[model samples]
Target chain A: MSFSVDTGEIFGYLGPNGAGKTTTLRVLLGLLSPTSGTAIVLDADLSKDDSMRRRVGVLMENNGLYDRLTARENLEYYARLYEVNRPGNRVTELLDFVGLTERAGDMVGNFSTGMKRKLGIARAILHEPEILFLDEPTSGLDPEAQHMVRELILRLSRVESMTVFLNSHNLDEVQRICSRVAILHQGRIRALDSIQHLTSAGKKTGFSITLADTTQASEAEDLLSSFGGIGEITRNGNVLGMMLVTIHAHEVVTTLVKNGIWVEEARIQKRSLEEIYLDVMRQAEGDVA
Target chain B: MSRIMVVAEKEVRQLIKSRNVMLSALLFVGVFGIFTVPAVLSGMGDTGAMMDTLGFYLVLTLGVFMGYLFTAQVFLREKQSGVIETLLCTPLSLRELWFGKVLGVTIPGAILAYFSAILIMVTGSAFTGQTLVPSLPVLFHIIVVIPAFIAATSGLIGFTQFILGMRENQILNFVIIFGIIFLTTFIRELTGPEFSVTWTVVAAAFGLALLLILVTAWLTRFLSRERIITTLSE
Candidate 1:
């Protein structure tokens, strides 16, 4: 329910459809007043301090654009609102940055969803705000466009030293870019931790091994079945997959080789962010039930 | 430029580019300005007095109607599309934003009102076979008082749009359109053939307009970012 993002960290907020992610975002952006607690950004209450909003930028799901205006005009209008220095130059630079230079004169109503999202990002950081908040940044984008957006977010955080608070349902996107995350359910944070810790710090490590032939796979399966600290063993053709509870991947491979089973490949698999997120959601649902 | 002026400038530009709206506004003013002169002259007595009366009530009515039309575009459209939410996140205060949009709507509404006034004068002169000029008081009403009234009317409507939800605004829009039509008809009935434009009438109208503006500006204190935002979804 309560947490703080570090100065320049990329914090991911994950939740289901009705988990109040947007309500929290609205409160943070000063659009909605929180009922009980305070939502502060950059050490200032955005609702109370008008000037402090100048240092923060946001791109909600709507993209906040006027369809009647050209792409350039939309950015220029926001640029003037922020009082950015040399708004013309800044707008041009951003149009180029978001790869909308050729379409600058075209009305945004004619633009694709991806194009609008790109322009929205450019508008958000037009003033070089200290922190940026993006809600569903790559929601409707194609794979290539999604990749470009992900790369842009990473570049902004690393090069501009701008803190990012990304609210997204794209687990793969978050796992690729975000350093830490908070999973919220039913208006409360169910799990909050670094991606590294959540994926690897569990008691069981997912380990997989592929043998050279079906005969060798059968021997390895038999060997792993009799071995302690290994459970849930499943096989398909020459591949063996199981959960390693009390033993390490190296020890498993060493034992197989000692048993004269030719091990073609033995790999340690880290649990994915999607798995961790689903586990958290299930736990929360179980608690409610 | 100040942020208020910036917002006003963008709004003006957008209104200008809205060709359909501009065309419709021009059509409304053109039809009323040209058609009303013959009816007024045929039923009235004094030529100059009739011209002055036409200038006073018609131009004021046109200005107010223009304000009503553009206020929906300048204020309600943004709220409906959720662009206002982004504007609220900026450093500009709610008062400044409301004032800026009022100015934006007022400028265009007044310009259209001016066009309607000139059209009325030209059409009247062509029909009467003599150059007709409004009295000094009527001239003051068209040149100065009309724009002030436009600003006041648009400011009040824009304020209401910012505070009310979509369904309420839709209902308000219908009420306003009907009310303007009824007021126009009522003005025609009240101004008999013997009625004359005088300094007293001009001064009283100007005072009323100034009062409306001050009242609208005072009413803006009740506007809040939360109210505007929460109504966006509705």
Candidate 2:
């Protein structure tokens, strides 16, 4: 679980529910004193002094806004807590950034879950913190809202050049934006690497070939067998299945046609992140079967 | 400009915006309106003048209101709304957090106490045709009494609520608050102590404040922290 987050890069802290994700963030924020081990954030010993929290933006799932205050008031309150000067303009900028400008005067109690989530993010980033820690940030957001949140994170990282440490149980959500991911289980690090490195190491690509007839299919299969990196080819009716190899997918089709096998269709199969996550978890549990 | 100052200001503004704050202010004012008549009658026969008698009664009024409002909102709202978690996440030191809350809640509360005192002075002046003598004793009464009352009320309310489970043990807390307020009033009325020994009252106020603080700390150390961590774990 010891890794560094580079500035301007998105890092996903992937783990199971209650796998110490929130606890880890809390320690980093200096809200919790670690029982053992160290949480070093921005060169400060988080356990010793929490003054660094002023430079960090954090959004917790279901951490509701003060229901009695307007959206503007809530932002102003956090800005003040972070000691941001001239909080009024910062409040306006954050409201606009979250598309909450129109609802700035409205009580946050009346807002929808998605709107509240957006506002929570706005409050966190109001002071332009150097790092952002978002825990299950898009838990209940719809697809479009999730996309907007992702885009917002990207914008913040690129424009502000901030480091983001994201904690989520959603793997696809991680893959969509994270430059790197660390998988955790049972209070230990199971896997830590860039997505490209891990996928290439532990996973095999898969593809389904849909052809016209058995003669063409057999011919394609024979050609594909000699074509380096096809694993366990299977056939039924006019369909063909194989685990793809280290070689680029286009190389396979080019090799097929050169061998006089008419090309009908070739597609590299996709593995869902959920499947990969399950595989990683099962491996951690010593239950490959 | 400082983080603690920001948090303190926000807390004060929040207390002001709540309906509970308005009602508490109005209740203290209503007490002044009612106490003013009797205060003036006492002043008509006084050698010391209206302001001195009015000042003592103002202290009494402030004490009761402080005891009541300190419990109703500051203790109840944070417990109910779940905002306490977010507040604790700030970089505010624990000492700063505690003092900030006490100050924020008490400032408006002190202003309300002063409002009642002014009402008493005005009514005493108008009804008895006696101008208030704003002397050193009158100043002493306000400076000592208003803050003592505020501190005592905060101690009583905050300690009981944070320790006894303000959200869960409603009946137990209500009984405790009722008993404390009732006993304090009953004892003060019976003591009939002289004004010069006012430090005795201050001592008693501080004693109550310290007890509340001790109970809050013990609960956090022995019980509340584990409960919060376990609940979040689940």
What is the per-residue lDDT of model 1 for residues A19-45, given as tens digits with 9 covering 90 to 100?
A: 988888989998899999899999999
* lDDT, candidate 2, A95-126, per-residue tens: 99899999999988899888888999898787
- Estimate, for each residue in B26-49, the C-alpha lDDT of model 2 and write its tens digit: 775767555655735553555244
Stretches of candidate 1 off by over 4 Å are none
Measured as a fraction from 0 to 1, the native contacts recovered by model 2 come to: 0.49
DockQ of predicted model 1 = 0.84
Model 2 interface CAPRI class:
acceptable
- Lowest-scoring 10 consecutive residues by lDDT in candidate 1 chain A? A211-220
Q: TM-scores of the models, in the given order? A: 0.98, 0.80
RMSD of each: 1.2, 5.0
